[model samples]
Target: MSEWQQRSLASLGNYENGFAFNELHWSEHGLPIIRIAQITGSQGIVDCFPGVLPESYRIDEGDLIFSWSGTLAVVRWSGGPAWLNQHLFKVVPAAGIDRSFLFHVLQASVAEMGKRTHGSTMKHIKRGELREFSVEIPGNECEQRKIAQVLDTLDTAIRETEALIDKLKAVKQGLLHNLLTRGIDPNGQLRPPQSETPQLYKESPLGWIPREWSYGSLGTWLMGKPKNGYSPQEAGEWTGVQMLGLGCLTKEGFFGAQLKLAPAGDRGLEKALLNDGDLLISRANTRDLVGVVGVYRDIGTPCTYPDLMMRLMPSEETSAEFLQLVLQSSKVRRQIQGSASGTSESMVKISSAIVTGLKVAIPKPDEQSVILCRSKALDAQLQSELQELEVLRAIKAGLMDDLLTGRVRVTPLLKSLQQTAAQTGA
Candidate 1:
């Protein structure tokens, strides 16, 4: 066990505000700059060549930065070396402290400060608030080092897991192209390309596809007519029933959306009750996300959708998974985009007329079942990785809350816990 000392952050180092370089200094070439946007995780950066301002404005990878206004976050800059813009505080740690440990402490502090922030229009913490914010540090630097290392290990795992998910998604994207185009032959392997089996492939309005596969509008696959859902004012009370928003549509399929509870005994309600296996598409969203399709998984509670989305109850013969995969394919997405993709601040709405008429090449009923099984396998892989990522994130949050806040001691159990954590992840 080790004793901890309390100290104000201001005593540790200078809280230098990022340089407020003029627009004239901005350039296309030279050091990319970190603005408040960059600090809040927007990748866009403004480039400023050297000599634009004094040397004190630059920040390196791993340097701790705090965005004090608008949005609050503590980030260890991992991007290329860049200039620190205004409205940000770059803490240059003083001697006798580890930067990694200080980073975790500062992150916890910013989050706590954000909760206590005061403002009507825009919440912000005065410099005095941050200056006097107290922090606890182990008297033994070695213990602080171990705790940071442990947390960093968890952070690294989280990043790697996310990276793996991204890689799997890339693979899935490629898989989708092949699965939808060539499809699984009776042998359960990807069918040969058009070049290998020209007899099996033919040219259509949508391009080359398996000869046995048929092309038709999405409307044909629906068991019942496609219809838009009802949108109404959010339920006046929290205790009312749930209504769905466009936010419910996920790339994987229907995940839950913002829970909008309707007022008790509200009108215009009965027709909109969402049923299990209902395929949903967003009629209005950002350009990139417009026409995103998903299947609704009934959450065991009655739910209804809004007018910004379309629900297509698939035909009895059609596999919901197969239809969703087709809608998500790149070619079909391009058609959806062609109909309504635009550069507008207002939401770009995809009309049911355009979406329902989307052309797709579909396999027979038996083949769709096989494709569904294969697609589910891919989804299972991605979902498994995502689940692990969620668990690692939970573990890291617990560590930061406990270890950084001094509620849980990591010193005595450090090595044993480290070994256990090592066994569990990459």
Candidate 2:
């Protein structure tokens, strides 16, 4: 702590805001105009700028960029040379400052910057406000590098885990599509696609499916009517009854993190109470998300679904897990989205008729079990990696708080490493 000193962002670096590139300046082929949306990953850089601009506006790989409006985030640019758009600042670290350390510190300061933002629609901090934001840093550049090295290691692991998770998800998606169409053979292997082995498949309303599969409307496999859930006024206090939000049912499946407390005394509450393994579908949402399905797993609390969702129970002939996975298939998803109707494009509704009438290829119970077992195996791997990611993030957050604040000194750690290296060389 003795070597650490508080420093303002302006003192450690020059913050250069990018030029405002409007639609008129957008071109199809040229250097990308990096926007805040592109930094946040909500949008890609489709439009580029052909005209050369000032050197200050040109950002290359390994530069530090801070998006100051809407979303406050600090990113290390990894893409090729491009033009920087408005509301973003290109940070040039001072001679004594470690660029990597400065990048991590800025990321840690985003929440503080967010608190000082103005404007109702799009929040932004003035340059003066940003300049005053301070953080504690060690005066020694060597100590700074040590701290940055520790964080960078964790970041590398996090990035690799994220990449692996994405690849696994893509593989799982392809496998799922195959299982739903080509299906598992009697020997417990994926049947070859119709393109490779035409004799194994037959034509159906849904498309070419394995000969062992039967095609029919979803209603034929349902135990009873698809009941709509209940919605009551949101309770300010915990009333012991939790209601699932529209976000709870995602394409990946049920996520209870977005739950809201509901009044237990609501008249129709009993009807909406969910049982473990109960399959749910969004009755109303955006066209892309309207018919998203998930199964309610016990969260160790009494929870109910809202009116925007519908509950279904599969007949003895159907496996609930298989049905939930099937609903996520591109074919079934298209049917659900295609049948959806609403006055606003942002919000749409899918009725029971549409859900029941959607065509599907049903596999035998044993085959369904085999398919689910394999899918769950992949899902388990994804979830494990996801959990590892969460832990790594939490660890990074803690390390940044300690290492950056000088609470957990890296000077001693650095010396220990240096001694170990010398001994090894000897």
Candidate 3:
């Protein structure tokens, strides 16, 4: 630890929960009410609630707000007056303490606070507990300002890199949608069939596909579900068998990083061992998330799926990657949501029967191969961009830890902070 002073969070600021605003008082236009959902970052706010509030409920510029539920983070003012709701805690820093510095301290301690949270269901932070939390503050105001400036700069960089990555991904998704739905020929023209032959496009179980295409369900092609059934035991690193759960599947596709290793056991469902090119579809989840699909490119070791996921291995005619994309499309997602069954709002589940009945469009083998190759290339490019974004994010997180903790000095940036303050004052 650096040579610094320590103080409870209460010493620096008073924490007070916002008042409950009635639904009847809300209107489309008026003072934007700030809620826990709106306080997402250290500085300023985005996605404000479009509700009017009494003038007395307004929070002034530069006041900090922290979320009281789910995720906790300090909210900075963007030079505007706003009203706060019950799920937020406003922290008014005492004179002489930099609000930005306090925000950074609270953010850096979020991980520790999360671990300390106690609850069987929804975890939360009590005001008394938060007030007692201690933080190491720099010896002087100059030091505090320097630290906040450095961390803020790194955060800005990370945000910019993330934005770039998102734009690139959007571009790639657009390409995939176009390439798969309307293929490109050697001449770079859409491979639409001749206009004279309207029958060239025929209705299949999955909707209209090329006339010569076939329609089939995933069950028709898969060898069978993975043999090993679901395991309740926590996974270990050295365990030879790897088990893929719902976490491994992302909205875009399979995220290899989410795989966990399972210890060998006689969990009867072992027969469903996964292989390269195998497709996994989420079988149980929210209406929109259920039936999400991903193609397995590599399984480092033998892996089995939980009962909540369905394994799909296409027969000779269809490409696994092609089917994976088809399953992930908006049209297929709607079909899955429409087919789901459940009584409770939170218990929607898609059964194997529903999955087997899902209709898929299949093109000729050669065209399937073309579509698969193009998609894989685009996926590779997207993965590269995502990796780069992850690296930038890691750097920013590390910088935040060091800067906020006072382990790294930012004296060199003092002039920048002063200049920023001066410009804003002017």
Candidate 4:
């Protein structure tokens, strides 16, 4: 701890707030202006400034950006050169501080600065409050660089893993589309598309499908009648019963994390109780998310679902896995969206009749099993990458705590690296 020095954020960098450009200043041409919404890198440049702006207001690649208001975040600009909008600060590292290290330091301080935020409606950290936030830094610049390098390496790995996950998702989507439309052959291979082999295809209500496939309403695949879930009032404490939130079901499948507690005195939820491998679908949601289906996996707690969702019991003839895959298909999604009813575009409801009437191209039970196995294989790869991402994130968080606070020294690690390099050179 003696090797580290305590310093305020203000002394570590130049925090320059951006210009407040109005609609009048915006143009369709010229450089894009980055706003708080673009901080996460998900949204693209919406507005632009045609005229030349001051260099201080412009951010190039690798510039540190901090959003001081509503949903505070710190990021190194990798979205190319752009103008920084107001409520965001373009941070520059002080002489002794490493730029990467400073980025990490600010990233770590977001939570503490959030605590000092003022205003009720739009919470924000004042310049004075932001300047007062303190961090511990190593006295030696080399050590700081080394620590930043280690974290940056981890960041690269995390980003790569995330990219892999995204690619897997896309691949899985394509695979599902192919498998659901063209049934697998007895030789355990995906049959070619109708365009390549029309002789093996047949025209169905849903469109061109494999000759062995038959078009039927989803109701034909169900054992028990479709049932809506029960919704209970919010309980302030644990009630021994949990209710699945609408978020529990996603296009990707069931996400068990979004469960809420059922009211303590609530009853008559027995019919709504969810069991393992139960297929659930959103009865009411946005147009895009409505009718999304997922198979529930038990969370080892007494759980019931909300009224916004419905549960389907697959009959002996249907594979719940195969049915779930079919429901997520683009054709079925479009049908669901078309049949959904609501006054607002933000929310829509689907009746059980709509669910039952939607037609699907079904293959034999054996083909369904084969298709499911392929889907599960992709799912297994995706899950592995997702788990790796979580572990990498955890490791990065631990490294930030240890390295930034001087609890873990990077000097020893650096020395070991130098020795290995020297040996390699020899």
| TM-score head-to-head 2 vs 4, winner | 2
RMSD of each: 3.1, 2.5, 5.9, 2.6
Of the two candidates 1 and 3, the one with more favorable TM-score, higher being better, is: 1
Question: Stretches of candidate 2 above 4 Å error?
Answer: 414-426
lDDT of 2 by residue, 161-270 (tens): 99999999999999999888888898878887799999998999988988888889999999887999988899999888798889999999999889999885787889
TM-score of each: 0.89, 0.95, 0.79, 0.92
Candidate 3 lDDT, tens digit per residue, 227-261? 22375565655668777877788788887776666
True-structure Cα RMSD, model 2: 2.5
lDDT of each: 0.81, 0.90, 0.71, 0.90
Regions more than 4 Å wrong, model 4: 234-240, 263-267, 414-426
Clashes of each: 4, 0, 11, 0
After superposing candidate 1, which stretches have Cα over 4 Å from the reference? 37-41, 44-53, 116-124, 195-197, 236-240, 341-344, 418-426
Candidate No. with top TM-score: 2
Which digits, one per residue and each the tens of the lDDT, describe model 4 over residues 1-426?
A: 887898999899998999999999998988899999899876878999888878999999999999988778999999888899999999999998999999999999987777778888888877777557888899789888999998998899999999999999999989999999887999999998899999999998988999988788999899866899998787889978899999999999999989898887666788898888889999999999999999999898999988999999888877777889999999999999999999997999999999999998889899999999999999999999999999999999998999899887888866786899899999
Which candidate order results from sorting by lDDT in descending order?
Answer: 2, 4, 1, 3
- What is the per-residue lDDT of model 1 for residues 173-256, given as tens digits with 9 covering 90 to 100? 998899899988888899889888889898988888888888888878776666888877876667546887777886667788
- Model 2 backbone overlap count: 0
Score candidate 1 by lDDT. 0.81
CA error at residue 68 for candidate 1, angstroms? 2.4
Best first by TM-score, ranked:
2, 4, 1, 3
